[model samples]
Target: MSEPVSALQGAIFEGLVKVEEAGPCGMITLRGDLASTQVKTAATGVAGVDFPGQGEANCAGDKGLCWMSPDEILVLCPYDQAGAGVAAIDKLLAGTHYLATNVSDARARFVVSGLDAREVLAKLTPADMSPAGFAPGRFRRTRLAQVPAAFWMRDEHMFEVICFRSVAQYVFDILTAAATPGSEVGFF
Candidate 1:
């Protein structure tokens, strides 16, 4: 018996930017009224952080909450804890108008870092990625080179872009190519 291999195992391409899968992680999509106290309380209980406002993200230890829309927030945690995470939230909002669906396997995350990280993202997205604008603690659900994706800025130099599991390799390839030598993609 052997441990399961990563989807991008043995894949390494380095340049001014570095890209790697975030491995398995809990990704739960929570949908409910943003103003509901039950929603906020339950969300905070599981994520250890308050529900983020639109276009924002909050991190408390390894748990994070990324606001995806006016009525949706994505909870991120350890992969193995996804089921428990959902159960905890569901218990708290038993009768509320909320929906918590574990989307861990349906999605994939890629961490893009290094001096050229922002530049690499700039080539794929139309959203503002300037330090002054899309700074840390912010996230946006946007498209990356024609593929729907969401990016969370953990810091000025580190970001994690998430997309469907099916297109993860394609997404990686594009990011790798963008970071390759002579890509002509310039960092802001």
Candidate 2:
């Protein structure tokens, strides 16, 4: 098999904040009973974070897990480890009714960093991006303009956004436009 590359090849737009297409990030769409100890142990062991609560994203080092829904979780790890990550989880819950699929290549990741990053994202997503409302560690699976997307904070000034690979450019376009130098909303 050939090596995988990101949907957008090093795309970057720096305005009020820096909007850049990030490198491949390993993602796993893990669906099962979030409340089961068997399921929770298998997932957290692989992702390196305790399973996140509703709308929460918890991480340890470069690995993490995001709570997508009551029965769904998004697993994150190094881009190259996604396949193994899935296999490990599968093996751990072999007899359970669970599904762990590697979705690393189907998604695109973008990094928006700067003081105005939250405002840049606020323009595109309806989620409360306010400092006190949507604090770090919160994961939002919402619409970025017309497309479905998800985003979380890396720090006070840096946010990471993810969307389907097919709509990467559109998402990037809207993000950059929202980050235009004179368009700062100062909402955060």
Candidate 3:
């Protein structure tokens, strides 16, 4: 079997906050009728989290489900467990017109954390990183500088961002620049 590798092998850069490729995160893209109880069950059951509403993520430490669309969710788990996670979903939703795909290798994940995480990210995206506008559990699919990315707050002081593996370096560089010390934007 091919061993898994993180996009940056957990590269860390300290600045206003901390930016690092956390690790290889397991991701499964499941497309189905979101309103269906069977699909909801499969998603939440796999993530050990509640079903999230639109533009929301129900995650704890990078493991849970992010609402991708009205008919899609991204299941998060340990990198090594993604294949098994897909099998579980397939078995759970058999004959239910659902599609569950392991997408772990297609993306990279990072932890943008610390007291200044919000300001650091706010400098890059158009999203309202202000506390009142983007609270915890809220998930947004938006661009970071130029590349498409998704992010959510694990809490008030921590955020998780994910983007295509092909642009991992770009994302990392942009994030680090946005967070470079002595360059703090006290916008938040």
Candidate 4:
């Protein structure tokens, strides 16, 4: 008998592809409208490592961490560190006007890396992926395959694509089709 398809299975449809993992390595969502200074101060105090400023991506390196935004960040530490990281942030910004919600389980992340990564993205995204357009170390909240996703440019050939967990599979399928070999559609 044939095996049933699991919801989490990573399928290769066309050229667009998705990783096996459903969500990111780790994620934290921060909400609140605060002054830039307040947000920076809170983030710096909470982060064991340096925080990336606007238009920058901070690599925690051995610490296994990355900051996603001025108000939000994603750490790649082991599962055990998730709780501690959130707590530290909570403690540091105790008096600040902000809301921090641990959303590690709410979103899905896929590492789309390859020579054709940008090309595949171009199919679904309206943003320009050219070097002059979206440079490396940049990230943008955009739609991918008609799904709301945040695209983090890891390098010239790689991107960290994130989307909601519920529509992750659909997004993946769209990406696969765009990445199919010999497809004329250019994503980047």
Local distance difference test, per candidate?
A: 0.84, 0.90, 0.91, 0.61
Write candidate 2's Cα lDDT for 7-111 as tens digits. 998799999999999988999999999999988998887888877889999866668999899999999999889989999998899988999999999999999
Let me know the TM-score candidate 4 reaches against the reference structure. 0.76
Tens digits of lDDT, candidate 1, 121-160: 8888898887776888888989999899999877778888
TM-score between candidate 3 and the true structure: 0.96
Ranking by TM-score: 2, 3, 1, 4
Each candidate: how many clashes? 0, 0, 0, 11
**Residue range with the least summed lDDT across 10 consecutive positions in model 2:** 179-188
By lDDT, the candidates rank as: 3, 2, 1, 4
Off by over 4 Å in 4: 1-24, 32-38, 41-49, 60-78, 184-188
lDDT of 4 at 20: 35
Error of 2 at 138 (Å): 0.6
Judging by lDDT against the true structure, name the best candidate.
3
- Candidate 2: stretches off by over 4 Å: none
- Compute the lDDT of residue 55 as modeled in candidate 3: 97
Worst 10 residues of 3 by lDDT: 60-69
- Give per-model CA RMSD: 2.1, 1.0, 1.0, 5.3
